[model samples]
Target chain A: MEITELRTPCLILDEKKFRDHCNWMKDKCKRLGVNLRPHLKTGKSREVALCQMISQEGPATVSTLLEAENFFSWGVRDLIYAVGISPSKFSRAAELIKKGCRLKVILDNVETAKALSNFCEKSHIEIPVLIEIDCDGHRSGVKPVSPDLIGIASALTDGAKLVGVLTHAGDSYGCVGSKACRKAAENERDSIVLAANRLKEAGFNIEIISVGSTPTATFAENWAGCTEVRCGVYCIGDLVMAGVGVYKLEDLALSLLVEVIGHQKEKGWVITDGGWMALSRDRGTASQAVDYGYGAVCDVNGKILDNLYVKLANQEHGVIVNRTGEAISPEDFPVGTKLRILPNHACAMAAQHHSYHVVNDGKVIAEWPRFCGW
Target chain B: MEITELRTPCLILDEKKFRDHCNWMKDKCKRLGVNLRPHLKTGKSREVALCQMISQEGPATVSTLLEAENFFSWGVRDLIYAVGISPSKFSRAAELIKKGCRLKVILDNVETAKALSNFCEKSHIEIPVLIEIDCDGHRSGVKPVSPDLIGIASALTDGAKLVGVLTHAGDSYGCVGSKACRKAAENERDSIVLAANRLKEAGFNIEIISVGSTPTATFAENWAGCTEVRCGVYCIGDLVMAGVGVYKLEDLALSLLVEVIGHQKEKGWVITDGGWMALSRDRGTASQAVDYGYGAVCDVNGKILDNLYVKLANQEHGVIVNRTGEAISPEDFPVGTKLRILPNHACAMAAQHHSYHVVNDGKVIAEWPRFCGW
Candidate 1:
């Protein structure tokens, strides 16, 4: 099937760009001498996961249990359920572990740790767990020097083992330039390494030290104490990555294939079938230096259209307008004209669709399915 | 099953509220003497569609062909593919028409109208088409007064038939107060009625005159010269609707059931399993009179937690903080405590999940499946 023949408002994965990005990240990890546990949270496709994996041996970080199950079914044995485990999901995690999937769950609170321990004891399972260390006060995770870290570690008494410390410098995404990103990366590395050292001094076996975020993984010059890096969005770079100078515009591997259905010429707008439902409602780049409203408009061949951006979007209709306030003629972009849209955040945009029409050299090479629900 | 037993970060549909909202819209349409062709674009569920239908006979408006097909399978014979029709979907639309589905496609451009006409001529099936009228300069649609309106209508030849004019006052969503919403509704009613009159004068039989929007349909006291009012979102009220004064907080039918995962005590933040992936990245209420950061925090029983809002969100983590910077003790809302969140936009949030866990009087009554994809 050809690219144009596929339905409009569907996700298009640029195969060549995707492979290039994966290879680039692999090379970066190799140079840094850290195991690259690519987060499957971005693509959530078994095929994409295979491309991201260091080898078929299978070790990956998944944001949700559904993703963990998906990758495990695809023969990914070593998986990390990256989100903090609540009591409700303990049995589900135990079920996956019982199925011979070496799953590792993470948490920062003593209550959840004790709950996991209790669940493990009842289920007769020894589940490996990681303590989430907060590097930049971004989202989840405990402070590197928090006294409760030991309490959380001690609470893992029955069948729950303290595997290591994990930290995600999500605040690295907010860093504007290379200097700031590098600083955030250093902070990320130091905090996790500090937590690891503290655990070691306390006589706990801190086997793994994991830290990452696409921005930090790409910009961090040093990964001395970290044994593995977890990055997801780097495989499908977006405007947010570009905005933070982690990846260039040409590095973005995902774009929404849409068609111009109509035009509001008076407003210099050309309406397309892709809207928030297609492009996603992620305005990640809104606070960045360059705000691509909805998404940056690109031609069918993946060439960025100058000054044209998806200015506004309804459920299934996107209004593309020229940033220069120049009127766009309806004759110029007639109805049925196919176009590509580079999204603001690849992860969020990709989540909107079930599968991607993989395109290489303007032709549909394959279709890769992705899992969605919690 | 109980509400607390269901997984975290999942959609919750309040059955009683949903039935009430649907009944209210039904009565409103009855008072206006217009058919209520509830747009299924919001709650894309067969059961919800059945409840929203004026009669079991079923006539609705869908934003995508996938929705039309889904509803068609559920015995919804009449469906209007409301978004502007492009050529690529012509075959799919025709396939549905051939299956005894009275599917009406809409378009605002002459090019697409010609393409539809060409496709119908070749397919040997007369497809009903509606010319989209721009009620407000918000999104897609041709201006009602433009000569291109008749041109687009005239392009329908061979197997394509011009049914009437359809317009959605999407800008009414931006209106803060009832006065502005009523004015927008007036514009929506006038523009579509004007287009219908023009088409009639040009020797065309205008059968169905359609105009609507949630805000407009809720506030519009007048619906003269319109055969049917197409409105969605009102069926599943949200923070965006509440922000516009269309629905009160209690009227919202959909809420996200999430678990408290962790906390940032210094910042007085309580992190939960719900994030943008669950609540949606919509921020539709950001520009409204009251900005709900991500979503409004609610108790498990559906009571609003005053001043507590989702201040930050990651892919699987939402941080709830007090608006007045008051500290919340971790013990007060411990880990594993389930809570509900009212989304900013129901349509966007609903699209993130696969199904809604129906709750009534604090119990899981049913699980309603929702289809997503295009």
Candidate 2:
């Protein structure tokens, strides 16, 4: 069925477009001679993960255990709990690891290491953990090149198996464009190598040195120090990617299908059914060179309407403003107008919806529900 | 159970605090001689609604028809759907009206008015409509003094019935303190009255002249022309309310319980399991008087420890910084230490959780699961 016949405020995924992205990224990994364990938290759909998991037992990264549980049940074997693991999460991780899930956890401190090790010992499980490195002081992880790096890594191993170091060049998101993103990638590769060498010198054998982030992974020129890449959003580019010249609007395969409900010609505002609830409240791209207020408003065929941008959105109502097109006259878009919205941040937006209305050749073909919560 | 023993990433609601907020607002309405139609979207729990409900049937403003339906199913009678009526939502509202829900919907333009009217006509439902007036320009609604508003209100009644005029001073969120919020309330009260007067002069009898926003309702002065007040956030005060000086951090009844995961004492950053994913991506009070990045980091007992705050939040990790603590460390917190995170915005944060963990006298008395999705 066409998107118009489905329902208002639905998530539409272009099947052909999605497959192309997955294949393209996989090919990139092949050419770079590295493994690609795509972060499944971006899609959160088993079907999307399977479509993208063209090789192996489907290596993936999970933001929540709920995702790990869902993906493994879907037959995905290799998985990394990307979020920093707490003592409270030890039992759950041990349960999964002992149950034969190739579950890897990340840690940056000694307290977590002791608790994790104690929990593993009590459960009679030896979980593999990657020491998270803070390439840049963006979010989580420890400084990879620091003098205390060996101590931190040793503490994290705490009787558990060591799987080298993993670093994400998340700061690449702030890069001006592709050229800058490449530099960020090299920085990430070097940081991991420096940390890995330090660990080996300190008498630790490391097996998996992983580095990933969409911008960095997409533009990496070196994979010498990295065994696996963990980029996620490349499968469905978003407005933030477009803002940083990472991808164009045409490359966005995921968008919210919304219906125009009303318009204010005098005020140049068109109200629609898809709001922050569908698109997400993440204004991640707002600080970029070009601010996509919420997302670029488009037509049913996923064609960008010249100057229409969703300026503001509440719970269930999105206020659309046409920067061009007859100055947003009421006549420009009447009732029952089906529109598509390119999300600012795909990861955040994708999490809000339960399922994606899978489309191929401009018509919906199937439903792929996503798992949420802890 | 002690806060730490209960659960991590849980929503804790204080019964005594919530009841005081509700009673105080109702008492204020009684003193001001105005009708209090609390918006149920904030809590979205029937139990919370019952606490806020003063009248026999309980008057309320709903953001969605589903909320209206749910509340009506639980015996609520007087309700106004405060959100702008979209063409897609017209049928549902019309159906509910036919099903004996004393529901009134809002509209800002003539085209949507006509569509809603047509739906009501086809469904043989007499829908009560209020013209949404934009008083603060924060979002939604027609300008209170716009010339075409009366005509739009008239059109909606052709197939249904015109209830009156409504305005929500969302700009009150920008108010620095209670005095400014009081002014916002007066502005909201005046805007609704002016719009009602305009409609009256156009040969219409206004049945409902309403205005609200927690800031305005709690601080409003004169409710002379306003037949009803619509406020939502007061029932569960948050960091936004704390920053607005409307409530202290202690008054914030709901918080996200998170476990300490990691730390960098050298950098004075402590990481917790609660992040933007669990807390929501809204930096609601960042621009207010006190700019707590994500939220105020409180001790397990809800005590704000000096200048500590959950500064930067990732998907599943929160960076807690003790602005001026001597040697503050998540290392000291250890892996099992539990903390409370007061959210920036109550509605958005509450929406992310599956349910509220109701705490009375420091005990989890019940679990009220919240329904989500569009």
Candidate 3:
């Protein structure tokens, strides 16, 4: 079926571009001499994961346990639940571990590590955990050089096994060019490796050292001590990645398929049925060098419409207007005309839909299912 | 089960508060002497609809075809697909109508009216349509006084029935105080009534003159020429509604229940598992009198925490900080501590979850399922 026949405000994934992106990340990992633990938090589809993972049964990272559970059910066993572990989630993690899934959890504080140890000891199950190092002070994680690093690792005494350290250069998203991204990558690598070395010196056998972010992974010239690079969003590049200079605009593989519904000629607005519900309320590109209001506009064939952007979005209505304050002709895009919208953040956009219309050369080849929630 | 036992980053709906909100809206509409067609777009749950609607068979408004389909299957006969109808969605709308649904579609232009007429003529089915009018030049809809109103009305000849005129005070969201909302409400009523009068003067029978928005509906003193007022969101008050002065802070019925995962004590950050994925990226109150970053922070008991807000959000991590720049003690909210986050926009936050844990008297009584997608 053609994409035009599908319902409006639905996700459209370019199969060829998606495969190319996967191959690029795989090749990049090979060149860097690091394992690519493709983060399933972005694509969140088994079909995409089939092409992303090096092996169908191993090496993946997920933000939520639901992703870990779903991927593990699909035979991807070597998974890392990348977010900080809370006690409420321990039972679910333990269940997955007991089911023979090699699921690893991450934590930053001693309190959580002690709690996990107690829970694991009581449940009679052993779980591997990675001490999260705060490389950029971006979000969660312990400071790389702080004493709490060893404190957290030492607290994992009974059923919790200390593996190594993980750090993400989340601040790399703020970097605009390759130079800044490269610096962020080096800082991320140094931070994690320093923490791992400290743990090793303290008599803890550290094996794994993970570090990554889309921008940092793309521009990192050195991956000396890092064993694996955990990066998502690069598999389906978005406007945020494009603005950060990690991926070009044409490399974005996701777009929202919508049809022209009405026009406000005097205001140069061409409205569509795709609103925040479809594109998401993420304004990742609002503070970037180029602000694509909600999303950048493109034709159904994926050709960029030079100056058009979705300026204002309602719940179910997107008002497309010229960025340069030029008038948009209603005759050019009449009602029923199909248009594709490139999202600002791929993960946020993909999270809004349950399935993707896998399009290749102007035809939808298959429907790849995706799930959400914790 | 207690809400504390439920998973983190899940929705919690206050049953008593929700019922109270429903009753308040019902009483307000009764006093105004207008029909209250509760827009099902906000509370997209059967259980919640049981309280909002006047009967099982609804006079409800939906933002998407999926909502219309789901509500119709639940024995709702009278429904309106409130967004502008696109050609790709016509078949789905027709199927619902053919299944004995009194579904109405709204549109603004002559081209779509002609397309609907042609489609209906070919399929030999009758469908009613409302002419969408531009009340405040906010988003979609044609100008209320435009000559194209008669042209579009005339084009709805074949199998399409001209029902009446409809206008939503979407701009009313920009109004802050009750006085501003009252003026916006008056303007919304005048705009739709004027359009209905124009269509009637053209010798066309106009039956439904509908006008509403949460703010406008809450403050509308005169429902003079309107037959029905369609309002959602107010049923589950949010920070946006509170900021608009339509609903007080204590009236918000929906919140995201999340558990404390870790912290950055030096930075006064208390990180949780509920991020943009749960709370949503709708910073609807950012431009209001007081900005609640991502959401207003509250305890699990739904008590508002003084000066605390979710200042920053990642995909699966929410970094909360004090608005007054005061230091936060990690000992106060240790690991496994649960907190409830009041959302910025009820519609956007509610769309992030699949179900709402109905909390009454500190216990989770039932699980009410909600859905998303177009």
Candidate 4:
């Protein structure tokens, strides 16, 4: 089936671009001499993960336990639930582990560590955990040099095992060029390595050191202490990634396919059935070098329309306008005209859809199902 | 089940508040003497719609054909798919109509009207349509005074029936208080009523004149010349609605219940597992009078935690900080503590979760399933 035959305002995944991105990340990991535990948070599809993972029965990174369960059911065994685990998640993690998932969890606090350890001990289940390190003061993680480093690890006494340290250069998204991204990468490496070294010196036998973010993973010149890198969004580049110089617009595998319903001619706006509901309200590029309002406009075959972008989006309406404030011809995008939108954030956009119409050579080859929620 | 025992970062619906909001809208529509065609785009659940809808059979408004189909399956026969109709949606709309759904579609262009007319004629299905009017120059719609109003109406020649006119005061969301809201409401009423009068003078029946939006519907002093008022979001008040002064914070029935996962002491940040993935990427309140960063922080008991909000949101992480920049006490919100976040837009936040945990008093009484995608 062709994508045009499918419903408008739906997710379209370009297979060629997706496979190329997967190979690019794999080659990058190989060149850095580090294991690739591809983060499945971006594309929560077993089919996508199969092409992204290092092996069939392999190491993968998941943000939610639901992703862990779904990927495990699809036969990718070695997994790490990358988000900091709360006590409420312990039972679900244990359930996955009980079902033969080589699953690992992470945390950055003593309370959670103690609770997880106690839950594991009581449930008679062993769960390996990584102590999250705050590299750039981004989001979750303990300070690399803080006293809590050893406290969190030592608190994992009974059934919870402390394996290593993990850090994400989330702030690398703010970096514009490769120079700044490389520096952020080095900081991510040094911070996690410092925490890992501290754990090693304390006789904890830190086995794995993980660090990544699409920008840093792409531009990093060094990965000395890192044994593995966890990166998502690399396999599905977006306008934000393009702004960060991680990849070009040609590398974006995901796009929202929409049909022109009408036009507000005097205002030079082309209204489409697709809105923020399908495109996502992620204005990640708003603070970047270039802001593609909601998303950059593209043709049905995925060629970027010169200066067209979704300037405003409501629940079910996207007002496409020219970036240079030039009036758009209504005849150019008449009713029933199919158009593609390159989202500001691929992860956020993909989450809005239940399935991806995998398009290959301008035709939909398959429908890959994806899931959301915890 | 107690909410404390449930998972974190999930949608919570206050049963009392939801019913109250539903009843409030019903009473308002009754006092105005107009049919309340509640828009199901906000709460896409059969159970929620059963309460908000005028009847189980419904005089409802939907944004997508999927919603029309879903509501029809749940016994809502009368629905107007409120978004402008694209030609691609004709077949699905026909199917719904064939299945005993009194489905009406809206459009603002001659191109769509012609295509829809041809498709309906070919399918031998008579689908009623409403000509959309640009009430506040906000989004899609033909200007109420535009000549294209009659031109598009005339283009609908065969099986597409011209019912009347519809308009939404989408810009009313920008209103800060009731005075501005009332003005926006009057403008909405005048625009649709004017378009309806024009259609009537042009030899059209113009039976169903519809106008609404939560803010406008709540403040409209007059519903003159309108047969029905279409409003959503009123049944699920959000920070955006609160900012518009349509309702107080206590009237908001929807929230994201999240668990405190960790903290950054010196930065005065309490991190939770709920981020944009749960709270949504909609900062709709940012442009309003009072900006609730991502969402206002609330305790598990549904009481607002004054001066606290989600300052930053990653995919699965929300950083809660004091609005006054005062350091937060980590002891006050220890790990595993449950907190609720009031979303900026009800429609965006509810789309993130697959189901709602319906709470009464303090315990979860029911799990209402919801759906997404088109």
Candidate 5:
């Protein structure tokens, strides 16, 4: 099927570009002498994950247990449920672990670690757990130098094994230039290494030390101490990655296939069916050097329409406007004119859809299914 | 099952509040002497629609074709695919019509109207279409007073039936007070009614003249000359509705059930599993009077946590902070402690989940399924 034949506001994955992104990340990790455990949180499809996998003895990271179950069903055994697990989800995680799915979980506090330990002991299941280390104090994680790290590690008793430490340089998203990105990468590596060294000093055999973010992974020149790097979103680059200088506009592998539905010519807007529901409400690049309003509007063939951005978005209506205050005539983009929209954050946009119309050379070569919900 | 036993980061529908909201809107519409065709775009669940329906034969408005199909399967025979329709979606809309569904599609331009006429002619199907009228120059639709309105109306020939006009006062969302909301509501009513009158003068028997928006429907004192009013978000209000004065904070029927996973004690931040993936990135209230960061933080039973808001969010992590810069001890919100988060935009937040756990009197009574996709 042709790309234009698919329903408007549906996610479109550029297959060739997606493969290129995966290969680039794999090659970058190989050059840095670190194993690449590509995060499945970004591309939650088995087809995308297979391209990212280094071998058939798969090791991948996921943000949700749903992703773990989905990928595990597709023969990817080694998986990490990267989010801090609550007691409520232990049974579901244990179920996957008991089925020979080497599922690993992460946590930052002692209270949850103790609860996980209790659950594991009761179920007679040993679950490999990683201590989430805070690299830049961006989101969730124990401070790299905090004493609570060891306390939480010690709390993992019975059937819970303290595998190693992992940290995501989420603050790397705030970095402006390549120099800042490199600095973030260094901080990300140093922080995780510091926590690992502390764990080693405490007599814990820390096997894995993972650290990564799309920006950090793309620019980091050093990965000396980290054993493995986990990165997502690079598999399908977005405008956020582009704003961070991690990817060029052309490197973006996903776009929403939409059509011009109407026009507000006086307001210099061309309304499309791709609204926040399609492009997502992620203004990841809003605070960046370039604010691609909702998204950077593109023509049908995926070429960026310079200066055209989705200035305003309703639930099912996206108003595309020229940034330079240029008026766009209604005739120029009449109703039924097909367009593609590059998203601000690929992860959020992709999550809105259940499947991707995988296009290669302007033709929809395959349909890749994506699962959602916790 | 108890509300506490449900999984984290899932949608929780307050059944009592939802039913109350529905009854309030029903009463309001009755007082105004206009039919209420509740828009199903916000609460996409058929269970919610059943509450909003005036009768067993529902005449609801849907934003997507998937919603139309899902609601149609549940015996909602009358539906309006409310967003401006393009030629690409004609076949799907036609399919629903052929299946004994009274599906009404909307469009605003002559180009699309001509295309729809051609499609109808080829398929030998008389599809009902409403001319979308622009009331406040917010998004899609032809200006109610424009000559193009007549041109677009004339284009709908050969198996395409002109079924009057409709307008959404999207700009009404920007109004601050009840007075402003009423004025916007007046404008919405005047514009669509004007368009309907013009179409009738042109010898077209216009029947269904419709106008609405959550804010407009809530505050409009007069509904004269309009046959029906449509609203969606009122069934499950959000921070935006509160910001617009359409709903009080207590009136919001939807809140996300999330667990406190970790925290940044020094920063007075309580981290949770409900990130943008759960709460959505719709910063609808960011420009409002009181900017609720991601959302207004609430207790387990849906009471707002004074001074607490989700200040920052990651994909699977939400960092909540006190607006007054007071440090909240980690013990106050220990790991595994559950909390509810009110959303900035209910439509965006509700779209993130597949189902809503219906709670009544502190107990989860049922699970209502919701469908998403184009």
Candidate 6:
């Protein structure tokens, strides 16, 4: 069935663009002499991950046991549990390792590592693991110079072999342009490399040194010590990337195809059936220079109004507040007018919908399904 | 299992409180001498709808076709597609009507009505509809005094029967308390009644008079001209109700239970696994007197700290900013401390998750599955 006929408030993903994005990342890795083990936390799709596998050659970074299991089931042999493995997930990690899955869990604390060690020893599950080093204090990971890092490594090393160190400088998302992004990426690489050397000086053989973020991975000039780079948003750029000047509006591969359900002519609101349901509540662009309140509003022909943005949104209702002209209330665009909305964050917005109607040249050729939850 | 034991970043619904809330609204309808047909848009779950169904005979109000179809499949006979119906959804409405689904659709334009009429006539489908009257300058609905109303109704009432006139005072959400809310409710009722009277003068018998919104629904003192009332949010009341002083914090039936996965003790930031994913992107409480950035940050024991709130959120990361503390950081909470977050809007937050862990006495007795999409 044609996409236009399928109804509004639907997810659309382009296969050609998705593959091109994957190839672009792969080419960058080949030039840098590093492995491109893209993260699955961005697009939790087996098909998308398959592209990453084709490009990377081996394991990919995962945030959940579900993702690890899904990718493993798809025949991706090596797995890197990117996030800090909690006590609850230790058993599941052991189970996957016991089942012959080549899983390398991440650790950042002595407490978590001690628990993991106990579980592995009891379950007889030998697993290779990496220490998550904090590069820029974005979310989780131990500080590069923290004394607790060595303590945790020693604790977890009883049953799990320390493969190397990993770091994700998520704060690089705040960089204004490619130059700033490259600087941030360099800092990210240096943070991990320096930490690896410190551990190496302490008589530790660190093989894998990883650091990644879409902006950093795409713009980083030098990769002195990085072995693997983990980036995801490059596969499906969003408004956040556009705000950071990393990617243009045209480069964004995903959008919610919505209909002009109603309009508020008095306030310049173009209401659409696509609410937080189709487009997730992730306002990643909020902290950016241009806060696309929710997202960029476009016309039926996918033409974004230069003076208009969705200022406010309700459940299944979007208020497109125009910066110019008389306020066009919900009356302006009567009904059944199609529109394409550029999302704040491609990952979260895409996660809201079940499947993406892969579109290219105004035609939806296939539908790719996405899975949710841990 | 206790909610605290379940994984962090989970939705917990209080069943007993939900039942009580339903009964309270039902009793209010009995006192007002109006049929209480609730708007199920707030509690999108059929489980919550079935709980509310205990009050009215069966059937309910829905914002989307998916909800209507779900309720219908659950043996609900009379259903109102409360949201505006565009030409695109005409076929879906016609099919439901043809299958003996007594569904009433709402429309605001002659252009749309003409299209719907043509489709219904060609398909031999006698669809029942309600002329949507705008009680206030809020969201969707045609103005009661709009000249286009009569013309659109006359054109569309060919194969379709206009059994009612519906108007919702969504502006009631802005009102302070019962007095303001009551006035808004009266305005909502009066606007629809006036439209119905106008239609009656034009020889159109308007049988059903619908008016709703949680605030207005609760304080609607006079529904003399209305036959049925539609109110949704009161069942699973949210922070909006607390802001309007309609309900206390303890009265709220839904909350997101998250765990402290990562913390910044120096910065007073407590990062959880539930960023926009589990808690939703709806900052409904952002506008309230006490702006809970995402939701009111409560301790493990469910006690809300007026001094602390989730000030900033990223994908799977919530920064707990303590307003009164020297440095507000949730990292102060132990790595495994579980916390409860009361969402700003129950409707939007509830839609983000797949299912609800039905809780009673702080223990999860059963799990209710939640369906999404149209």
How much is the TM-score of the A chain of model 6?
A: 0.95
**Best candidate (score: DockQ):** 3
**Candidate 2 residue-wise lDDT, A1-374, digit = tens:** 76888667878998887888899989999898888889888898888888777554678888888888878777788999898887777777777776688999888876677777777767777889888998977877878777667766666544477787888887888887878999999899988888888898898889889999989988878898678999888898899887777788888899998887666656778888788877878988778876778889888998888778888887777989865544687676786788999999988888777899999888789999986677
Label model 5 with its docking quality class: high
B-chain TM-score, candidate 6: 0.95
Model 3 segments beyond 4 Å from truth?
A: none
TM-score of 6: 0.94
After superposing candidate 4, which stretches have Cα over 4 Å from the reference?
Answer: none
Best-to-worst lDDT order: 3, 4, 1, 5, 2, 6
Candidate 6 per-residue lDDT over residues A181-291, each given as its tens digit:
988998898899888988888777799998899989988888988898998888988999888887887777787888776655445667778777678777778888888
Query: In what order do the candidates fall by DockQ, top score first?
Result: 3, 4, 1, 5, 2, 6
Pairs of colliding residues, candidate 2: A134-A142
User: Residue by residue across B1-374, what tens digits does model 2's lDDT show?
Assistant: 56656657878888789999999999999998888899888788888888887964788878876788888888998889887777767777777777787888887878778887777777777888888898987777888788888778778655568878889888887787879999998888888888899889989879889888888887778899888888899989998887777798889888888988777767778788898888888877767767788888887777777788888887888988876655675546766788888899888888777788888877788887775665
Q: TM-scores, in order shown? A: 0.98, 0.94, 0.99, 0.99, 0.98, 0.94
Candidate 2: where are CA atoms >4 Å away?
A156-159, A263-266, A322-327, B55-57, B73-75, B324-327, B330-332
Model 3, CA-based lDDT: 0.92
Tens digit per residue, CA lDDT, model 5, A216-330: 9989999999999899998899998898888899889999989998888778789999999888899988898899999998899999899999988988889899999999988
Q: Could you tell me how far off, in angstroms, the CA of residue A93 lies in candidate 5 after the best superposition?
A: 1.7
Q: Is candidate 2 or candidate 4 better by TM-score?
A: 4
Q: What is the lDDT of candidate 2?
A: 0.82
Model 3 lDDT tens row, A1-374: 98888888899999999999889989999988999998999988899889889999869999999999999999998999999999989999999999999999999999999999999899999999999999998998998889888898889988899987899999999999999999999999999999999999999989899998999988998999989999999889999999999888888899999899999989888999889989999999999999998999999999999989999999889989998999899999999999999999999999999999999999999999999988
DockQ comparison, 3 vs 4, better candidate = 3
Considering lDDT, which of the candidate structures 1 and 6 is the better prediction for this target?
Answer: 1
Q: Which of candidates 3 and 6 is the stronger one according to TM-score?
A: 3
Docking class of 1: high
Candidate 3 residue-wise lDDT, B216-321, digit = tens:
9998899999999999998999998898898877789999999999999899889999999999889999899989999999999999998999999999999889
DockQ of each: 0.84, 0.53, 0.87, 0.86, 0.82, 0.48
Q: Tell me model 5's lDDT, rounded to 2 decimals.
A: 0.90
* lDDT tens digits by residue: candidate 6, B300-328: 55677677777777666677767776675
Which ten residues in a row are the worst by lDDT in model 4 chain A? A1-10
Q: Score candidate 6 by DockQ.
A: 0.48
TM-score of 4: 0.99
